[model samples]
Target: MKPFTESMLNQCRKYMFNFFDYLPTKYQASARDWQVRKFVWAFKDGKCAVSAAQLVAKKIREQFGTSASDMVFVCIPASSQRKNEIRYREFSEEVARLSGAVNGYSHITVEGERLAIHESKSGKHVNDVQVINFDKEFFKDKKVLVFDDVITRGYSYARFACHLESFGASVIGGMFLAKTLFV
Candidate 1:
């Protein structure tokens, strides 16, 4: 596993458990790796995501065992425009189902203007307030494991965890398919 930078650790103060970083998005030569791209495509067509989820489940079971039962899996919702193009709910739900965890309620929504940030190299152009909004309910006193396709700067994960905590939910940790070596 890649070590968490001080910035990432700082942003994750609200979480009770260490964030799991499963894969690297690039190699030492700074090229996009096939595994990362294939994992992303798995959300749309390939079966790699299922395998990845199963691996994650195995890891969680080994580390936490029956304690995994209390955790609910949730994804960072894609923007409305992206949702029209690709259904991310399937990716997240499938992970939850395979992991044997409860899929938590999600009310996160993004604005249209923020969609461009996903195409940007660093994903630092978007701020917390401009990117997403959270529902006041749906996660009271629950334990959540937030999942996302990638982690560039970790802004989204930080904000999502904070929002969930504000609603009385305990953010156990976060999971991502890959971690980018970008700002």
Candidate 2:
């Protein structure tokens, strides 16, 4: 596969930026600036993060041939329910584009009230949000590539991997379009 190009990075940035814009105006500036700086560093590094992930995944596949079971690309949900819904959908679209031509897989949304449940004392009637559901058969013996927009602390990814492993699926790889390497 060709290394990620400036155009690809720019496209990714566009999506990330759009996501940032969806945030409340008060919260968007610092987050946007932070993402820009991260993108600059990642751009200068010339696909180093993505390339490393691809290389590592390829090696693992070569060592242990891929399974017939389908893949599930997992994306973490934002704290805000509205933003989480939007990002989850956008992340699904992006995954479809990035994994083009690959068969035997589908998209699943990970979001609030289902995947990541939070309880607050203020809520006695908090509605449960049903995001997406998958049958166990679909993921059995499958290889999952968890996708996230930016991975800074990595706790989210780690928790996701652990959950998949618990389900008897192999987390063969992880792909992040961008990451915060500096401040």
Candidate 3:
């Protein structure tokens, strides 16, 4: 894990872990790791692959241990509610269960349709496009772990962390399936 420096400095501390290296657009015949590319594509297309989620959960368990009950795990909301349901809902449940963390997947949510950040050059900030939902006291004085399929600019996790901090939550870090070429 490393400091998520893409986030604004002095925000509640945030660290991040990435399970795999990714380009997202690497399609060369000899680019290597076709499985990685396929897994990312499947996730983007709203296919929740339990095998990949299990792999991520294993890494989290190795790091945080089965005693992560104190940490609340959350995922960056999808572009819309339906996409979220199709992708992250089951993915998060399995990760949290296998990682021994509190399931906070549904705690944060999106308002409506929005352009995916990576699909655009000058994309909207994550917080601007998504409305969040959480219990007023759910995050109070708790450690939060943000989950995402990939970490590009880290804006989503960073913005979500700030929101969690606003409710007195301490962002322990983030867990991601992969990392893009840039941080």
Candidate 4:
């Protein structure tokens, strides 16, 4: 896993952990990279996604000593109801289940509609505040590990950490499948 520590517009110095770099569409010229991107985009299929989730689960177990029984895994809410339906399951929830951690999907919810950020060509086009609604009470004093498919500007995860901390939850860290470098 790769460590991320950088400051964004709204977020100060924060750290994020990612499994791999997501090759930008423009730079995915290699067959292997393209296939990996495809697999990430098509995670709803459950085969490759499940396998990748297992790997992430292993990393979580190794890095965070909190037994699976005590850990709560939360997925950044899906961008749209349609996407949620298509995916059939939230990637983070599945990873938690396979890894033996408690699923925390009900803790974080998406309240409003917003365009899928990744669908935009540029990261600046999307606003995360309009999309995510956090349940402050649900995470009180819990050890949480937040998960997302891909992170671009780190806005969503930063806000997640902030909210969790404010509500008295100890944010273990963020885990993502891939990260897009902001240039």
What tens digits encode model 1's per-residue C-alpha lDDT throughout 55-118? 6666667655777777877777655535622544555556566666776534555556454343
lDDT of 3 by residue, 1-183 (tens): 345553445433446788888865544533565777777879866675577668877877787886577788878787788888888888888877788888887666667677676555465444345555677587899888888888776666787777788899888888888888642
Lowest-lDDT window of 10 residues in candidate 2?
15-24
What is candidate 1's CA lDDT for residue 47?
A: 51
Using TM-score as the measure, the top candidate is 3
* Residue-level lDDT tens digits of model 2 in 1-183: 234544333333321211221222234346666656555344334333344334334533443344312455555544445544544443344333444312222334434563332234335565666553444565567666665655544555665555565667666545555554432
| Better by TM-score, candidate 3 or 2 | 3
**Model 2 lDDT, residue 94, Cα:** 39
Our tally of clashes for model 4 stands at 0
Q: After superposing candidate 4 on the true structure, give the runs of residues whose Cα lies further than 4 Å from its correct spot.
A: 1-15, 44-47, 85-90, 120-131
Candidate 3 lDDT: 0.74
User: TM-score of model 4 relative to the true fold?
Assistant: 0.75
Listed in order, each prediction's TM-score against the native is 0.66, 0.45, 0.82, 0.75
Model 4 C-alpha lDDT per residue in residues 1-183, reported as the tens digit of each score: 234334223332533578767788766357877776877777644446567778778887777655766878877666664555345355566678777788786655555557665555455565544456667788898988777778876777876676777788877678888888543
After TM-score superposition, the amount by which residue 167's alpha carbon in candidate 4 deviates from its true location, in angstroms, is 1.7
